[model samples]
Target: MPDARDKAPLLGLGLVWQQLAVGQRFRSFGRTVTEHDLMGFVALTGMQEPLFVDATHTGALGPRPVPGALTHALIEGLLLRGMVHGTGLALLETHIRPLAPVRVGDTIHAEVEVTAIRPTSTGGRAVVACAVRVRNQRDEAVMDYDVTRLLRGESTP
Candidate 1:
C-alpha cells in the first residue's frame, strides 16, 4: 500500500472509462479475508449452508468454506474501488467458478482483464465485460469468472 504522502491523484470517471480497452489488465490491492467478513456476509445474505456456518463439521471439503458469493463480491468490490469508484451504473451479470476454498486469514488479490466492450443502443451507455481471477497468497486460484456491467457515458440524461 502506498503511504499517504506517496498517494497518486484519483482518476475521474470519464478518464477511467476512456482507458478501457480489450486485453488490458489490472490488479487490485490485496485484502486479507477475516472471519468477521465471512460471517457478516452469511448473515446479510442468509446463506444457511453448513459449510459456511460450521467449522467443526469437517466434511470431504474440510472446515467450513467461506461463501462463494462473498468472495465474488469482494473481488468485484476491490476492482471497482481501485479503478472506477462511483462510476459504474449497474452490474448486469456475474458468473463465478470457485476452484478452491477461501479460508479466514487468507490474503487474496483480484486480477481483472477487460475482455469485451460493447456500445449500447443508447449512446450514453456501454456494456463492459471484466474477467476476474482471484488468487490467494499462495498464488492458487480460488475463483474465476466474468462480470458484465452497464457504464454510463457523458450523456447522463
Candidate 2:
C-alpha cells in the first residue's frame, strides 16, 4: 500500500523558519510578463506613466517599458508562492535597486540567497534576511533587493 505521505500535494507547503540557513540559495520558477499583466497593473495602481501606458511613447529603454514596481511585485509574488506561503508572518523591510528595464513579454524569475537568520525575541518566530536578484529570460539582471521577513518556526507557540 502506498503511504498517504507519498501523495502529498506538490508545493502545498512552505518552508518553516528553521529550515532556512544562511548561505542557502534557491531559484524560483519563471513567469512571463504579458501585455495584459502590464495593463492590469497600471490600471490597478493608477500608475499612468507614459512609459507604461503609452505605446507610442518611446523611453530610453524603448517602447513598452514595464514599471519597475510591477516587476518587483511580480518577483515578490513568485517568492511568496514558492517559498513563504503560510509560513511567512510579515515583511520587515526591503531595499530595492533597479538595474535594467523590464518590458512586456519578458519572462522573469528570482535568484535568492539566504543572508542571515536570527531568532526573534518572541518565541516561535524568527527574522530571515535574503538577497534577491530578478532576472529576465535573457539572463540579464533587472533588479536587486534585500528582503527581511518574519517567518514562523516549526514548533507551535
Candidate 3:
C-alpha cells in the first residue's frame, strides 16, 4: 500500500498522478494506416506476401488486409502511451486480433480500462493490469485483450 505521501508526481510539472483504479477507461488516438508503418515491419521480418503488400491482392478480397502487426501496434504501442502516468515501467504483455481487412487509410483506436494495480510483492514495484478494446473507425470491435506492466514508485530514486 502506498503511504498518503507516496503518490508519484508527474514528470516535469510535478503534479501528483492519480493512481488509476479498476475500470478506468481512457480514449486513445486513432490514425490512418500508412506505408511507412509496414516498411519497418518488412525491414524487420521481410515482406513475404502480397496480401500484406499488394493492395490489388487485398482489393481482390475487399479491403486491404492490414498487417496483424498494425493491430498489435495500435493496441500495444500508442494506445496506452499516455494512459499510465508516474510508472517508470515497460510493457509486459499484449494480445490482439485483426477482425477484418484494414486499408491504407483505415483508422483505428483503442478503448482501454485499468483492471488492476497493486504493489509487486517482492520488488517493491507496482504492477498494472488492463484490458483493451481495439476498434476500427467503423466502430467495430476488432480485438481485445489484457495486459500487464510494471511500475515503480518515487521512492526508487
TM-scores, all models, native as reference: 0.83, 0.91, 0.75
- Model 2: per-residue lDDT, tens digit, 1-157? 9999987865666788899999999999999999999999999999988888888997789979898999999999999988998889999999999999999989999999999999888778999999999999999999999999999998833
User: What overall lDDT goes with each candidate model?
Assistant: 0.80, 0.92, 0.66
Highest lDDT: which candidate?
Answer: 2
Please, what's the RMSD in Å of model 3?
A: 5.8
- Candidate 1 TM-score, C-alpha based: 0.83
- Per-residue lDDT tens digits for candidate 1, residues 1-157, read 7698656755543323545888999888899989899889989989977887886868666675687788888887787777666668888998889999988788899888999988788656778898999999999999999888877665652
User: Could you give candidate 3's per-residue lDDT for residues 112-155 as a string of tens digits?
Assistant: 88888887666557777878887778998877777887766555
Please rank every candidate by TM-score, starting with the best.
2, 1, 3
Worst 10 residues of 3 by lDDT: 9-18
The lDDT of model 3 is 0.66
Q: Give the lDDT of residue 117 in candidate 2.
A: 95
- Segments in model 1 whose C-alpha atoms lie over 4 Å from true places: 1-15, 154-157
Which ten residues in a row are the worst by lDDT in model 2?
6-15
Q: Looking at candidate 3, what is the lDDT of residue 66?
A: 62
Deviation in Å, model 2, residue 155 alpha carbon: 1.0
> Which segments of model 3 are wrong by more than 4 Å?
1-18, 58-61, 84-88
